[model samples]
Target chain A: MDFAEICEEKFDINRYLGLLCHPGCGGTSVFMGTSRCTSKISDKTVKALDYTAYVPMAVKKLKDVCVNARRTCAVGNIVVAHRVGYVPVGEPGLFVGVSAPHRQAAIQCMDLTITAIKAGVPVWKEEVYEDDTRAWTTNAECFWLPKPPTHSTDLPQK
Target chain B: MDFAEICEEKFDINRYLGLLCHPGCGGTSVFMGTSRCTSKISDKTVKALDYTAYVPMAVKKLKDVCVNARRTCAVGNIVVAHRVGYVPVGEPGLFVGVSAPHRQAAIQCMDLTITAIKAGVPVWKEEVYEDDTRAWTTNAECFWLPKPPTHSTDLPQK
Candidate 1:
């Protein structure tokens, strides 16, 4: 069976892995997206990440991706989860796992599932910097439009 | 730094994931090999899998693979662990995790690291079947040699 959820609670990697296990499957592959201590865009130290998602739409999209993965790969069980609200550095923000009879299929399913979610899900992230600067950043995987400027030139320079 | 070990204790997915987390890395990918309830060869019901590894040799080989992965992929942190002894069905036997600034490198590193271990490490597994049959099985990823017979059938079937 497939499982998908958008939770406000902490993401449990083991619990999800357990749910993905099957009697006939020997391999499980996982992808974890964490709130890193450093920002990829500005190289500034990051404190935490605040996530907001269109709950109903995001959950439906996650479930749809899990179903699609089963048809595309030889997957036995699949899990996809994203955490909303505040996530501290080194904590997991999103998780995806896949189990299959073979290693290749499990690996392929996990890779594809994560890519689909990043590209299609309506989840948004705001990086909370150590310097108290917060801005909505663009996910590199979502290459649809350019992000708006964080600071306006009309403001006085520091 | 990289970490690799041949452990006798149960595999902890979260601990290894934590080791792979770094301030500069935003993405982590993992591959976990578990003990399945069914055998891939005979389709027999399996209860558990007993693993044995030449610790010194296996650890050395694992470390070497980790180093090679660093040179190949744009990875920041890497962790590989294999559990020796009995691993129950749906429990993890082996785990590999890699973290990188981007998703592509993390995924590639995990994929290659697991492949290398299955092919080169001096680890062995004996499948314990529900019917009390025990036999050494070949890892599906190790595509090199043919496995020896578990029992000789010199006489007629019982």
Candidate 2:
């Protein structure tokens, strides 16, 4: 059975990897997304990150993604869990694990699983900067929410 | 700092993955090779696998591979540990972890590291079958040793 959850507490990679291991499977692949000290877009130094998710929607999305990955990859087992709360720099924000009878399937399944979660999950993030300022991060894939107009093309050209 | 070792005891994936996590890295990818219940070559069931290696040479090769992976993939940290001795079915025989600023680098680095270890490391394996039979598994990449003759063409066909 697949294991999927949105944790309010610290998520452990060791525990998740162990959960994904199986006797029939020969390989396990894992991906961990951690909170970095610097923001990728703005180059601003980040102290930490605060995450919030629409609990019901997020859980459903995670389950759907895991199911899709399992079907596509034909892996033995999988685990997808994300942390929803204050995550310090250097700590994990997302964790994904997959096991299969072979290495390629496990690795491919894990890659796809994480990509789907990042793109489709109803999760929001606030990047807390070292300067004591915070900004609501906009995800390119979360298209359900309205994004602020950025360029002239976004505005109806007068 | 990077973590690299050839272990005689069972290695834990959780510990290695945690060690590879760093504040500067946003992604961590891991690959684990486990002893399966069945052998890939034969239909025979496997009880366990015994691994032996030239420890000094294996350690040096592992370190070199890690350094090369770091330079090529621009990863923040890496861990490569392989078990030397008996590994039961479903237990890990080799574990590799890589962390980078992005997923692509981490994944790519891990893939390359595992391949290098499997190919060049001075390690050998003996597959113990359930039928009280054992066979020395030949690794394609371990070119330093001579392979046993299999066909008449390998000998002087008169």
Candidate 3:
């Protein structure tokens, strides 16, 4: 079965990847975003990343993104999870896995799903620096546009 | 450190992913091509995929692809390995992982690397069907051609 959830503890890529394996699928594509030690903006040393979300809305939105991807693409199974709270440097904050009858669909499913999440998810992130400072940051995918426009009305057309 | 090798035994995704976790990198992208039970051509159930390669040349070419990617992209560490011999359905036959300062670099690196492998690598595969039939197969990426042209002189310009 497909899986999606918000985890407070660290997430597992192996478990997620395992969920995408099916007898009908010929290819699976996966992407992971981890907390890095260096800040892209300032190049400062990073210690951890703090993530939070409006739980109910975030959960619903996350599932919607996956469902939409399945409908638009020729994919079979999908498993995606996001972590909340503090994610240490070098630790993954997001995991997305997709399975399809062929490689192209699988890869395209991941690409579309990731873009959707960045544009729609309600998750918030704060970068904790080693210099005893912290900054709330937007996902790099849409960082230039202040806080992303609220998704309630900004949702992709069905 | 970067890694590139050909494996007759099952290679570890966890091991390869672990190799990509570095303090300086904010993102790591990974792609795995597994032996699927279904064939896109006839929709037949697959039992296993038997792969063969000129070990010396295949190994050298694989490393060259990775080296070329590292030189061209903003990615940091990379760990890639291809399987030879038989790979059962639902098991990965190829794995590519790359770490970079941001997600874009990591993702693009994987895309470029996969394209290069499918277009240039000399691995051959035979599909074993559950009904006791077998057919030598070419990777789907370039299946329109009878067989991919020899890459002996097809290496990308350095």
Candidate 4:
């Protein structure tokens, strides 16, 4: 199953783990998002971040990722969370956790889940730089975007 | 920063998070590994697991992943932990956390870190199955071996 929350309260790692844990699973993967002290736009540092999301759409997309991962891999329970409102530097702003019957599947699924979240989920952020500069950002224009795929036809198939 | 440990003590989620959290980071991705109730070998169910690692090599590889990820992405801190000895089903077996200045970088680094751990670390496992059947297992010939590269082209990118 998939779950998402926009909370102001401090996120609990154990609690989230417990929620995503399953006796049939062997791995649980988690990711947490935090505000950074440095800003790329300017030399100034960042104090906090303001995050927003199209809740319904974002939730639907998250569930879709969970379902897709479970179907493709041997994964079990899953949880995805993103914080709204203001998040101070170093505080967790987003979290994604997944469980599977094996370490490989869990790790791969969690990785895919986060990548999908960044690419598909309707979450937006505004960086609050220390020098009082602010601007909105999305996954599409991020500096960390994965490079374009390269085609290769040289492999010995089993 | 980079950290790696194999502990017999209780897994402290909060303490792990504290180490991973950094004011210089804007995103943190974590992956927690847990024991499973099902065994792939036979009808026997799994009750718990014991993990052992080639400490020096494991630590070196983990640190390498952390350093490479930090240099390649906007990531800050990377923390990875694996529990050794008597991990009950549904209990955490490992945790990998990554903090970065952006969500994409954090996610990407986390994905790379976990993948590297699975592929490069020389860790072994002993599974205790239901009916008291026990046996040791290695990545050699395991169904999950030979992990794919961390680049986006390897998997369905986003």
> Best candidate, DockQ-wise?
2
lDDT of 1 by residue, B1-158 (tens): 79999998887666777788887777889888989988766667889998988799899999999999899999889999999998988888998999988888999989999889998887888888787667788776676646745562222358
**Model 1, span A28-143: residue lDDT tens:** 98888888887655666888988988899999999999988888999899999999999988778989989998889998999889988988888988888887777778877786
User: What order do candidates take by DockQ, descending?
Assistant: 2, 1, 3, 4
Which regions in candidate 3 have their CA more than 4 angstroms from the true location? A41-43, A140-158, B40-43, B140-158
lDDT of 4 at A79: 85
| Residue A26 lDDT, candidate 4, scale 0-100 | 67
Give the top-scoring candidate (TM-score): 1
Let me know the DockQ for model 1.
0.72
Clashing pairs in 2: none
Interface RMSD, one decimal, each candidate? 1.4, 0.8, 1.3, 1.4
lDDT by residue (tens digit), candidate 2, A1-158: 69999999988666776788787888999888889997855667888888988888899999999989988887998999988999999888898989899888999999999889978888888887787667677877565766622441212357
Task: Please tell me which model should have the higher lDDT, number 2 or number 4.
Answer: 2
lDDT of each: 0.84, 0.83, 0.80, 0.72
Q: Write the per-residue lDDT of candidate 4 for residues B1-158, one digit (tens) a residue.
A: 78877777778888888998889776677777678887665556789887766677767766776777677777677888777678888888777887776767776777777667766666677778766657665454435444422332213346
- List, residue by residue over A29-127, the lDDT tens digit for candidate 4: 776767777766556667888787767776777788777777877777788887777888888877888787776777777777777777766677777
DockQ preference between candidates 1 and 2, better one: 2
Model 4 TM-score, 2 decimals: 0.74
My TM-score estimates for the predictions, one after another, are 0.90, 0.89, 0.86, 0.74
Q: Who is ahead in DockQ, 3 or 4? A: 3
Estimate the lDDT of model 4: 0.72
